[model samples]
Target: MVWEYEVRYQCLRERDKAYTNWLNRIPHKQYALAFDGGYRWGHMTTNLVECINSVLKGARNLSITALVKLHASQLASGNIQVSCFDRQNEVFKVREMPSGLEFAVDLRGLRCDCVEFQVDRIPYRHVFACCASQQLDWQVYVHDVYKMDQVRQVYRARFRSLGNPTTWPAYNGPWFVPNSYLTRVTKGRPKMTRLLNEMDTRMLRRPRHCRLCGVEGHSHNRCRQSAGANADRDAQ
Candidate 1:
């Protein structure tokens, strides 16, 4: 339907040279077909990257050793296992016993039909199954970036101990300066409470009432009797 709309738009706006040119230039493969070679797997957005950023936001202030230890502990906590495997054209068939789903693993291509291995760059259950069948070390298939050894190497460089602040070298640099333009000014006293929108007002509102007669359903400002009374008072 979207593609049809684009095609219809091109026909309807034939005089629109830029729009026509843009529509013509759009490739069929880009919109009509899936990504070739499974490079993207099934992920279509940066939600995964955003999720990782959110997860690590809390640990950003932590020391390097603490970060490494946190990651190591998380890695150790995962429960993945290898079930049976079969060999065909060097493709190993692995079954995730828990999910009861089978996946084909290509050791040469370093890809699994399930797609998790490619995305995570780690040996999933299917890859594990393949390793178990061949009696090969599964750790070899895992990317070095995730390995404990690589994580340990990050903390190997010790931070030099700092002596007393009194013994520190005297300041040789220019005085610190603040940018005046970037400084924030009071924006009419900050609002701690949220302003009610139309939906919120509708939900929170009490039963409507006529202030003129103290009756429900209408307000005093809109009351016909009040208007008539006001007119009579003005005449008097």
Candidate 2:
């Protein structure tokens, strides 16, 4: 409950900030807002599992094939219904438009032209249909998908089962190497001697300038004159 309150407060604060930012330019008395937690806010905390459960309420007694067939039918019918709405709405908005682009999405009527929403009536799919048709980038509309309280419940349960990381088991494998065996090693050959030689040749070909001044050998980042108090030490 405390976490839910915190989340609600944060949402309210964010909305308040956005309102303030936009209203700064206009006069204060332009409009009045009712403090009902910012339009559809209460619904943000509820889980849609109840809706899904309602749809499958009688499925507990059904056979496996029946259940699978029912769900598949539901999903298909829902998606297609929503797509239909998307097509129609897009057509209405633009007269003589191509049939492929116009989607009929009627939110006010709770009728998504797509089959998904028409069959299943899932709100998220309606939003998805609308986003897809309108190119609104629906991933950013996350509040429609997850509830804060549910997220809190998950975190609480995880911590209760796993405890904290500070008490985790220490490494149990062998950790030491033999020191005497290291002395017998020879200096390894360079993997790309020719490449190193070419790089050196390029450097030599460059005009000799103070590497510190980008004047041939140096860059401003390493310039000696810019060394100020360290100039004498640099010269030495």
1-236, model 2: which lDDT tens digit per residue?
A: 33554565567668787755565566533432223334433343224334655677767479999999988877655542223324534421211112233345555354544544455544565466566666665554444326576677766753446668888898899998779866865676545422122214454475656654556656556676767638777788
The best candidate by TM-score is: 1
Model 2 off-target regions past 4 Å? 1-52, 81-130, 137-236
TM-score (C-alpha) between model 2 and the true structure: 0.22
Angstrom error of the Cα, residue 81, model 1: value is: 13
Candidate 1, RMSD to the unseen true structure: 24.8
Report, for all candidates in order, the number of backbone clashes.
0, 40
TM per candidate = 0.26, 0.22
Candidate 1: the clashing residue pairs are none
